[model samples]
Target: MSIVWYYDFISPFAWLQWPKIKALAAEHPITLRPILLAGILDLCGQKGPAEIPAKREFTYRYTLWRARQAGVTLNFPPSHPFNPLAALRLCIAAGSSGAATEAIFDWIWGHGRAGDSIEALAPVAAALGIDDPVAAIADPAVKAQLRENFDAAVAEGVFGVPTLSIDGRLFWGDDAHEFALACLRDPSLWNEPEMQRVAALPIGAARQA
Candidate 1:
């Protein structure tokens, strides 16, 4: 079965689940799609968890706990919510090059380096043998490609990062990884009927005209 993994570099959950996702890719055909989380959020008219003070605090604490449980070292960058446009564009430039893509994620999420600009990503590019990282980001084609990726992701009903789509079935969030894996292993699960369907809320309340 083929799976499409829609991911954003700035998502802590996406970074946390990368190892498991990569291992799953080893067992199945997986497509790594780099997308802009900001675009997706804007398109969906939703707010990120980090935008809320309470949720943001909980997210950081929970992320650290999860990282410890998983034996992964995760350090928050000097700042949160840094623009990841350059990193996203670089992934598009990499284009099926796994090493380059992995390095980008490692540099930001693993190393706690803020991925705000191309210059910040220079060391990562050099390590991955990408000689002209700055030029690559400046390439009009690269910029356009990333824009296209964002559009495509919005079309696919992706409202957040770390979404896995298999056979048109959408499984979102890092916590849903096991369920996605189960669906991949058992196609019959995909055919199961929906548990329940809730009617949409009334758009207009009873109007006394």
Candidate 2:
């Protein structure tokens, strides 16, 4: 079986889950799908927890704690909510190699760089041996591809990063890693009768009449 991983580099939780997924990739086929987290939030009409004043602090602290717990390195960028469009387009340019994706993730979340400017992204592009990243990001084809990925993600019901999906089953967030691995081990779990019935329950209503 194969897994589709939806991610955005700006997501710290995605950063934390990076190593785990990389290791998991060895045992399962994984296709990396990059989309703009901001775009997803916009489509869902939902504000990220970090966008809330009260939750922002806790989210940051908890992200750090989880990073420590996972033995993953994480540092918030110099600023919050910086645009990662260029870096993301670069990933599209790079053809979404796990190494390339992780390199950008690490640079932003691990090194805490303000990846908002093309100047900031220069070294990352140079290190990856990508010529003229600015031009690549400027390429209408690359821009269209990123938009397509975002549109595909929204259509697939993806609401967040690090979402693992197969055959219409979704396992969201970093905490669901092991559960995803388990489902991979037993594909039948994807269609258990009782679970399917439960999934059919109407939203905001406990029982269907």
Candidate 3:
């Protein structure tokens, strides 16, 4: 089976889930898709968790706790919600390989560094063997690919990062990792009556904007 993981470097949850997703590569082909999380939020008319003060604090605390429990090293970059375009475009420039993706994630989440400007991404680009980080990421094709990835993710109904798409099914968020594995092991899990019922459950009230 092949799994497409839609991710943005700005997300700590995506960082936390990377190792587990890598482990899945042992048995399944994993595609690392780099996208702009900000674009998704714009398309969905939503605010990112960091945009909300309370949620921002909670998200940091919660992700930190989860990382500790999972024995993963996680340190927030100098800032949350930093521009991820440079990093995302760099991934495209580097061919979007698993190693390239992991290295970028490590730069941001593991090493706790910003990934916004050319200076911030220079080391990562050098490590990936790209002689000219600026020229590589400045290629029109690289920019277009990142845009295409964002559009494709939106078409796939992806509203968040750290989403795993497998066999036409999407399992979102780090918390859904185990559930994704279960469904992957048993494709029929989604066909259960309750699953179908909840999928079609109607909204009783709509909040007015």
lDDT of each: 0.82, 0.84, 0.92
TM-score of each: 0.90, 0.91, 0.98
In model 2, which regions exceed 4 Å deviation? 203-209
Tell me each candidate's RMSD, in Å, in order. Answer: 3.3, 2.9, 0.8
- lDDT string for model 1 (17-54, tens) is 88988898788888888888888888777778888889
| Residue pairs that clash (backbone atoms under 3 angstroms), model 1 | none
How big is the positional error of residue 99 in model 2, measured in Å on the Cα after superposition?
2.0
Candidate achieving the largest TM-score: 3
| lDDT string, candidate 3, 36-142, tens digits | 99989998999999999999999999999999999999999998889998999999999999989989999999999889876898999999999999999899999
Give the per-residue Cα lDDT of candidate 1 at 151: 77
Arrange candidates by lDDT, descending: 3, 2, 1
Runs in model 1 lying further than 4 Å from the true structure = 194-209
The stretch of ten residues in a row with the least summed lDDT in candidate 2 is 200-209
lDDT score, candidate 1, position 209: 32
Query: Per-residue CA lDDT of candidate 2, range 136-181, in tens?
Result: 7898998898888888777779988879877557888999988887
Which scores higher on lDDT, 1 or 3?
3
Candidate 3's error at 182, in angstroms?
Answer: 0.4
